[model samples]
Target: MNGTPIRLRELAPDGGGQLSKAEQIAQLRAQLAELDGGAAQEQIGGEGVVPLGGELANVLPNGGLPRRQVTQVSDTPSLIVEILRQVTEAGGYVGVVGWPELSYAELSAQALRRTVAVPEPGLDAVHAAGVLAEGLDVVVLHARSEIQFTPAQARPLLARVRAGGAAMLCVNVAVPSPALRMSADIARFHGIGRGRGCIAGIDLEVSAHAKGWKRPPALLTLGSATGGVTRLKAVPS
Candidate 1:
């Protein structure tokens, strides 16, 4: 014939007309990897863990926060600031939703400069978080007493965080289901005198539990003075 040849469908390895299940899975994985930016995927710190620094790292099972995951923090503002401190110090951008009263003076100038604040509540707050997740490396949503998220509402926001390779910190807000839950209780005050001396520092008994961590709850001592995290230590159960 003088005409160009027609292409035929490729045959399966086992001589079947369709690909094998294993082959299909492999192909899907390859496609997903490509969509994920290829084999040399980027991680927050090459290990996918954002270091919390010093003793704070010792408390978490992975020695740091896992990027692209939700970490719910109880109503401890100082602790939240500590988490943000490490991320910002590493040259990451931070977005705060519905937390307007955050003391800027406690944060480093660079950290303050990198922070994006959205002090609104309700749906607007959630929308703000979703928008920030698109471009920020870390997003903190302060639910306070006004906002609570159901699984349906939280899934899309979390998906955005994962797709953007950002970490999410939910303050005073219960996540639909979180990978990690951290809470703090005031243990004692270090520098406060009866009624004369100014308040100096307070000792916080912090504990963390995660979904896959087999170890008992991680107990830690977090000390804050002058609105700053000054010390961290691992406490034996």
Candidate 2:
């Protein structure tokens, strides 16, 4: 995906149309829970896993994204680090496919567990997701699944994540196209409220068919997954 340009002609029948401003706001709120680091975060099974940082947790669905298969957080490696931290907890076999340097020797070892690091960090994302979907507890989908795949091709991959109950994090160079990335569960990014060097007040937008039929756009301030959670606005769907 480095040289290849991402196209979003399939986002809607007309073209890559933007989500209604109102709808975007609704989705953002739906994905996020509370703001600030002042919140109690309990893993699904009551394990106290050390988080990457306070900033990243607030951006997720439950103050942090869960490992239940195919949960993709669309952002950069900094954001992905926060997600990887959660995946290494108990009941979570973490696999960072297609992000070799960022996943293995480059990451803070304390933040990860027995990671199955993949070479060629950019190209292997989708392939690694396939292998880890059922065998692992969580998979960070750093590949651009939304760009190269048809909905039909992506369905099975997403389904495997669902069936396997694994979490996914997609590291995108650009905003994702809606047509290529739809699923039963989603935690969306609304926009950034305010920020400094690393700390930020980010507005996260989201909607999930499973969490609740009520998928509305809303807002929340997100912190850092590593130390610098570069906040950005949502790409118009």
Leading candidate by TM-score: 1
- The C-alpha lDDT values of all candidates are 0.62, 0.40
Q: What is the lDDT of residue 77 in candidate 1?
A: 80
Q: State residue 196's C-alpha deviation in candidate 2, in Å.
A: 18
Show the lowest summed lDDT stretch of 10 residues, model 2. 5-14
Candidate 2, lDDT over the whole model? 0.40
Cα distance off (Å), candidate 2, residue 234: 18
lDDT of 1 by residue, 84-181 (tens): 77777776666677776665445676666556555543334554566556555677888658457788877777887777656678887666878787
Writing each residue's lDDT as its tens digit, candidate 2 over 31-57 gives 212211211123333332222334334
Off by over 4 Å in 2: 1-58, 89-91, 101-112, 121-125, 144-148, 173-237
